[model samples]
Target chain A: MREPAPRSYRAPSTALVPAVELRGLVKTYDEGELSVPVLRGIDLCIEPGEFVSLRGPSGSGKSTLLNILGCLDRPTAGRYVLGGTDVSALTREEQAWVRLHHIGFVFQSFHLLPDATAAENVVLPLFYAGVRRAERERRARELLERVGLAHRFDHVPSRLSGGERQRVAIARALACRPRLLLADEPTGALDSRTGASILELLLDLHRRERLTIVLVTHDPGVAEAASRRIFMRDGRIEDDARA
Target chain B: MAARVLRRHPGRTLLTVLGLAIGVGAFIAMVSFAEGARRSVVRQFETLGTNLLRVRPGSRARAEGVRPAMPLSDADVRLLRREATTLALVVPVARRTLAVTTEAGRVHRTRVDGTEPDYARIAGLRFAAGGMFDATDLGTSNRVCVLGVTVARALFGERDPLGERVRIGPALPARVVGVVAAQGRTTTGSDLDDFVLVPRTTFALFLGATEGYSSLEVRPRSAALFEAARHELTTLLRRSHGLGPAEPDDFTLWSPEDTIRAAEETSRILGALLAAIAAISLLVGGIGIMNIQLVSVSERTHEIGIRAAIGGSPAQILRQFLAEALLLALVGATAGVLLGVGSSWIVAHAMQWPPSVSWRVVALSAGFGTVVGVLFGYVPARRAARLDPIVALRRE
Candidate 1:
């Protein structure tokens, strides 16, 4: 096997550049002539390997902030930087490229492709990353093993349980070895026991891999598991604290 | 993945594929039949000999309205033989519908053609029994006739007809001296084995002296000399008839090449018209595919969101749907070709016509099906590709 090449987008001096930096980021939705603002003037910075949780109520825009951070949506105004790159001004195509190379996302509902097996789901991001078939399958197998679902590699999402599906989604999110992992209510639909286990898995993965994680959740118990927590109300950050 | 997604909706995929198959099948069947007809015409012409030419009287509108065109006379035939050096032989033919009665009183209405002994050679006539009229029979103007296979079967049944006499319509009975070989339907759909042949002198005696010849059949010495012989015959006939430079020659020249060209042109136009009609059904099938694809996109909106979030670009999403559509079309096209060839074979067998399927026609139908798939699949694919991941993920 050939050695993997270094990423061109990574900064020459990695210590000076934070994993994520946002300066007055704002998001608004336009419904006909009405303009409803979602995220209003958010300012934050996250160092590499920090596990940060965004805590808020249902309408507090925590999910919206996570979407922007995942590069799935653009901020209407203000600068957003990811790994020293100014992503706020990027086009939709360029943002997709950045997401493919640098960011991974796990959604509230798991969103596993119902028709695909767990391994196939994990291999999808690698497919877009232009990885060869053998390498993709190898990586998918390793990631499924990492998530403790190695035996469930061939089980499709429809056949898997809620917790198993969430594990598969987490495995898929890590397939490309992204710099940042973004989770929005990842355990929202699980029972407490299953949710707690999923959180433990995430914490273990974070510590072992030194992964930068930005998790959004409404439950304070879930937020407390992170190394840093930012509390939001009415689309603005109300409190910030570090463990 | 595209195949897996399509397999999720088996019923819709089958229905769409069936629609495309039917359209493509109809196209192939019609084109193959038309091609068969064209090949049949060319084959008939080839058997009759391409070096042969026919001269017919040209018609024109007169002050008294349309009238029968002036027919060729014995003098024109003589003049053509004398002046046209490229000529091999010329036979003047006159036709009349006559009721023939056997000695046993069996009567059959049939076409009777009057010509010389050389008519058999020029017309590629073969003998199934006794040969055509010999030189003595023509020289003496003997009241003898040659019966076509159909006429002989109708008049004589199983008995030998070589020496049997058949009475012409209100004329003296003529002896059957020969039986011509069986020739099937001509390119014009006429039965060739339904006529009788007799000497021109005997026919003229029955019709009276002033009756003119219907047409003249000429054979060139070689295939390469046909055009030259035709030109020479035209010039000779024009001068002999005393026509001025401005006066139109009152004759029409026809050859096998001209006949084949005209037949092919007509069939081409007819084939195009049929193909266009068949294409409507294909369009309808394409619309059916589009409708199903649109429904699939809407149904898989969340799946689209998940893919987008995981780094599948819009172009990749578009390609996935397009591949599904294309796979459906290709499968339909293959099945359609088989159905088309099979049905055409059945029809050809039932109708006793030769079955013909060309590779070009198959290629055209398959290519057309693929084009329809891509054309109709574009809108749905674009819609799926353009979906906003945020909104799509938020949907229930």
Candidate 2:
């Protein structure tokens, strides 16, 4: 009944443009006329299928950047082109459309609905994409299996451990097969071994499917897993390195 | 999806639904019961005459303390019938509650009315079988009586009661000359068909010269002469009772139609009061719905974030919660209708009021619930739809 239900993406095969393109991005929070800038003049681009890790301490504006990249928040001034469409100037509804069709997000908290089973969590994005119920279930099963969570399909988030919850989150993120995958500390809440396994899962997904992944984390061990890493300090990128 | 969300807190949801149900049920029951009472009053009044008047002996204390009130007698019936030119019919009714025995050895206590043959036409008595006591029975003081439909059923259910003999007032045997058609309950909740009728002359044999009739039913020939006929009868009765010019009349004359009309007005006022109370209860129910919905919205703020982050639009979020509230209220409305109808029947029987269930009243009650649902669901749904996704997701 709304927006003609977004269509599926084509994996950006033989595409010339980057999956995410941002130029001179600025995000300012206004509290009683006091302008607190979070992301100031950030310029970045990520090619399709690239695995990138963003890292910084608190107050480094990495979270704001991730939120802007995921289309959950808008930059105060910037031109953001996702899937070759200028989306920063788009309306809030159009932004939601882009988020549904082009971006998949995994959070540190896993952000799985407590009331839904693991398979239902995985089916969420495809449901918003207007995929039919039978196909949604089939794809949920396929993605859950791909994430090595085939056994926990019927289990809710509370029934599964932290690593298992993160895997379900990953399966959910890939439900629509979005061109851009954003993870903000995907393993930040798990134990060291579990966190390492979650990171290994993300890297394995990247290598197996050539899926574009942009993850934010602090552990050098996590940064070690990515091919490229960007570090931010005080609202600006301080370092960029290739692994 | 809304059902799934609501099912998460089953206790709260059920309580909310029950609140709405009570409101709707109470409203429908009040209206339906009032309508039943109104219909009963109307039925009672319909059989009474516009030109009809009732006359009974006045109270003990007199306007002039000198004269003690004398009892009315059969002489008054004869005098009113002979002397009054404007009056159409003068029928005296003698009533007594006594136990009567049937031939089958069954005994039931019922009211007995002693009156002349003209009382039949005045009271609209139609016989199911046989006929009323004739003028010969009245002149001879014959031991013949007519059984009301209720008394006949109680005395001899499904059996022909025309020739049966029933004992009146302990061993005073009277033949059942007729059985009247069924008449419904009165406005005062007594059955209209629970009386036995017999000739006035024969009634004197049981009580050994009982003085007068219990009450008199007077009818004027036409509506135009009703007041004049009442005045002439009052004058004749006063003169016969030896009340002088300075003394007040010894009996009271009033129109039964007027009394029933006043009672009908009172019922209308009571109906309005009930509607007010019902409105207040419905308002309370709506507020309860809003309160619960707002709590649900606040409690599910994180879920809203998850939904929004997963690409559910503001409209979709709004639709989800609004639909749930409406669906819950409709279910309550349905349950309330059953509760109302069930309780109304029980109350109608317990209070002996007529049972009149109107489906229009049911629709109005359920429609009111729908209005209540939509009115309360909008606020919290809008609040949920407008939540900031980033901040909402950040909340624990």
Per-residue error (Å), model 2, residue A224: 2.8
Q: Chain B TM-score of all predictions, in order?
A: 0.87, 0.83
State the TM-score for model 2.
Answer: 0.84
lDDT of 1 by residue, A34-69 (tens): 999999999999998899999878888888898889
The global Cα lDDT (0 to 1) of model 1 is 0.85
- Candidate 2 chain A: worst-modelled 10 consecutive residues by lDDT: A1-10
TM-score of each: 0.85, 0.84
DockQ, cand. 1: 0.44
Over B1-396, each residue of candidate 1 has an lDDT whose tens digit, in order, gives 677777888888899888889888888988877777777888878878888999887643343443355568988999988878899999999888889998889999998888899999999999998988877777787899999999999988888899999997778579988899988887567888999898888878764443577789999888889889988988988887777786666778888889899889988998888888878877887888888889889988988888887888888888888988888888888888888888878876665466788788889887898789778999999998899888887665
| Backbone clashes in model 1, listed as residue pairs | none
Q: TM-score of chain A, model 1?
A: 0.94
lDDT: worst 10-residue window of model 2 chain B: B59-68
